[model samples]
Target: MRSNHSASRVVWTLTLCTSLALLGDSTLYAVLPSYHPAVGIGVVQVGWLLSMNRLVRPPLNMLSGWLSQRLGPRTPYIVGLSIGALSTIGYSLCRGFWPLLAMRALWGVAWALLAVSAYGLMLDVTVESTRGRLAGIYTSISYFGGALGAMGGGFLVDALGFSPAMFILGALSIGASLLALTLPRTQHLPARHVAPGVSLAWRPRLQAWAHALRRLDARLWLVLALSFAHRFLFAGVFYSTFGLYLQQTLGESLHVGAAVIGVASFTGTVLFLRNVVSVLVGPGLGYLSDVLGERSRVLLLGEVLGVAALACLALADSLWISAAGVLLAAMAYGIVPPMLVSWMGDLTRTGARGTIVGGYQTMGDLGSGVGPLVAYALAAAWGLSAVYGLGAALCALTVPLILLVRSRAAGRAPLAVADHGAHGA
Candidate 1:
């Protein structure tokens, strides 16, 4: 067995490596507008390019889980980074929609593989009690990298032009692939086997999937629903269109707008005060949920705060107001993922953890895919402000859904007892 220090180092290294690999994704948004105009595609087509990447996640995530079980997580993780590097290089040469779309799809598959594998490895390495804090650390680093990637790509595109900027992204991805090879080999240990004659056959796969759906434990479902909507709106409206909107509506230079949003988001995520708050206060909230036995309450608090932040953004008349909204939203947004992941860990058995987490991630991607399309449609009909308002409303809906989940879970055990007593009598 590895020492705790060794395990922690491995987890952090993997997290950082994953973050670097994902930097390519951030650069895509920066480079696409420039590339699209050169290739005669409308701005709306860029949204399709973004969403299409997510369209692959649901099925690809399922495949990733099975492959990880069979080949070990590290193997697939390395493979993913390699493929991602190649895809990034290919992206530098693309001139048309079809080539770009194909490269993005390849990148999506690589993302699914690396994400599922790396998360599984992280869970395996860390103690359950420390999972939330570790998750926060992981997410914070990832977002920090994203901010840098976005800003750097924008600057590079402005100075060096699109193809050369893409070449730099490809080079970074290749470096990340090299780093992935150094990850510890613990994942190669064989998983504990199921009993003989017990097979995860097609029928069982379908049955397990059905049971997972039906018994979806209301709390887990609520988290899924909230994450889906939250990410969808954030990605589709805020991430996908915010730069374009600022450029078009506010007449800000694209490079300046992208850099400002990137810097603000980065600064918000890296706040030492926020990290201290998450470390000190997040666990107290988590422990309270454990004691009260109500995960939904914590989730509701986070979502409500998020909705308020979104509303603030919607009403903001200046860049400063938008920056403030992002800071507030980041605090709440930063809290939810770790809390939800910890809750899932608490509710699941060790054997099923990988599959469940993979499913959860896939659903988040699905939401992300839908969000952009919906925002685009709404923007076309009404306006960009309408898109932000709708995001706030969707976030607000999560509050009630969380309460419903809590109620259902609370009643489940008592209802089981009543049924048993009636059968005995």
Candidate 2:
């Protein structure tokens, strides 16, 4: 993204690209849990497949941060997208467990590069005060696109065969990559590094962060901790296990292609509906966060609702009850991120945006990795329901931390001033 581009253009372009990428990838992700087991992979091993991205994310995140400075966000964005396209194609043809695992790992690298570049691009196009609103818009598109993508992929898989469905999804990524070529160049992110904003040596950079972390205030630390836990529940437990749970709940399993698709497709539709809630509610939440300037209250509410969502999932007696839970969870998911990122934006500096966002994402990555591995082990020892119960407890524990965010004078005093100042008519 060229920093000089119109915000509208950046928003639409980025949103569209994000949608395409997720739409393509979610198809594969939505199916893979059951698909893997059908092909003879073990349940514990499925956790590894779901989480292969985490293996490369920590280091790659740092590298992408540094790399984006030198090469510009556009270069990595395009290259990473190209790889995403190829990876989807790889999934279509690869049959061996090891090869598929490697592809999943490669997708992780692509994701790291894409996320660092994309989020940095977001920071470039907006001011600190405007972050909540913009972050909400971005998150809305991300979730909305994800919803459409997963739903589309599910139906396609249901109608066509798996390989054919993958081919179609792969093509979507290719199309998105081509569309990315038309993106306007960014001035904040120049084509090549004119200044040394980032260190090339990883060790020195790592050491620098080690020293720099001591200066953070209590609230920032709390945000990071919450990020880790929230993502843990999201990536590790919910996503990795949800499909399997559905299968178990419905008494469906591997090799029964149509029956399996019926169950998976239903879950995909539920996810689609949840994302729709995100799309509908996201803008309003973003606006609320900006007006209140007190992101903590909004964030805390989201956490509380998250606990409730988990409870619904854990103790669900019927699909309707689970759907209600999903709606609650989705709304909470929609609500918190804009406030979280906006709140974090307030705490950090523009110069440190790259590192802060990178670190923040890495925290989520850590949660995602740990959440699933532990969930898989626990579920194996216990059952799927245990994972949701634990998730609810952890989410409950984080509400207090979110409560500690000190609201800005702008947040506490008068929102009308903020309404005009942050978003001009």
- Deviation in angstroms for 59 in model 2? 2.4
What would the TM-score be for candidate 2 when compared with the true structure? 0.78
- The top-ranked prediction according to TM-score is 2
Tell me the tens digit of each residue's lDDT in model 2 across 1-425: 22323555665677777778776567766776667654456666776776676787887887777666655566777888888888888878877678878888888888888777777666555554556677788877775886677767877887886778888888988887888776644433234343667646778767887787886666667777877887888756887688788888775643345644577666666667777787777768777776775678778878888899888888987877787888888888788766766776666543345556667778888987788779889999988787798889989988765554454232443211111122111
Identify the candidate with maximal lDDT: 2
Task: Assess each prediction's global lDDT (C-alpha) against the native.
Answer: 0.67, 0.71
lDDT string, candidate 1, 1-425, tens digits: 33457556766787777767777777776567666786456788887776666788789887786676556567778888888887878777887778888888998899899888776666555544455656656655665666567767777877887777778888988898888777754333356588999776798778877986897666667666666776786644666666555554446332454464444344324343444443444545555555555555666777777787778767878877766666566666666766776667556543245666677778778877777778788889988777777788888887777776676676554111111111000
Candidate 1's C-alpha lDDT?
A: 0.67
In candidate 1, list every pair of residues with a backbone clash: none
lDDT of 2: 0.71
lDDT of 1 at 188: 32
TM-score of each candidate?
0.76, 0.78
Task: List runs of model 2 lying over 4 Å from the truth.
Answer: 1-5, 31-50, 92-95, 154-167, 182-207, 243-265, 314-321, 379-387, 405-425
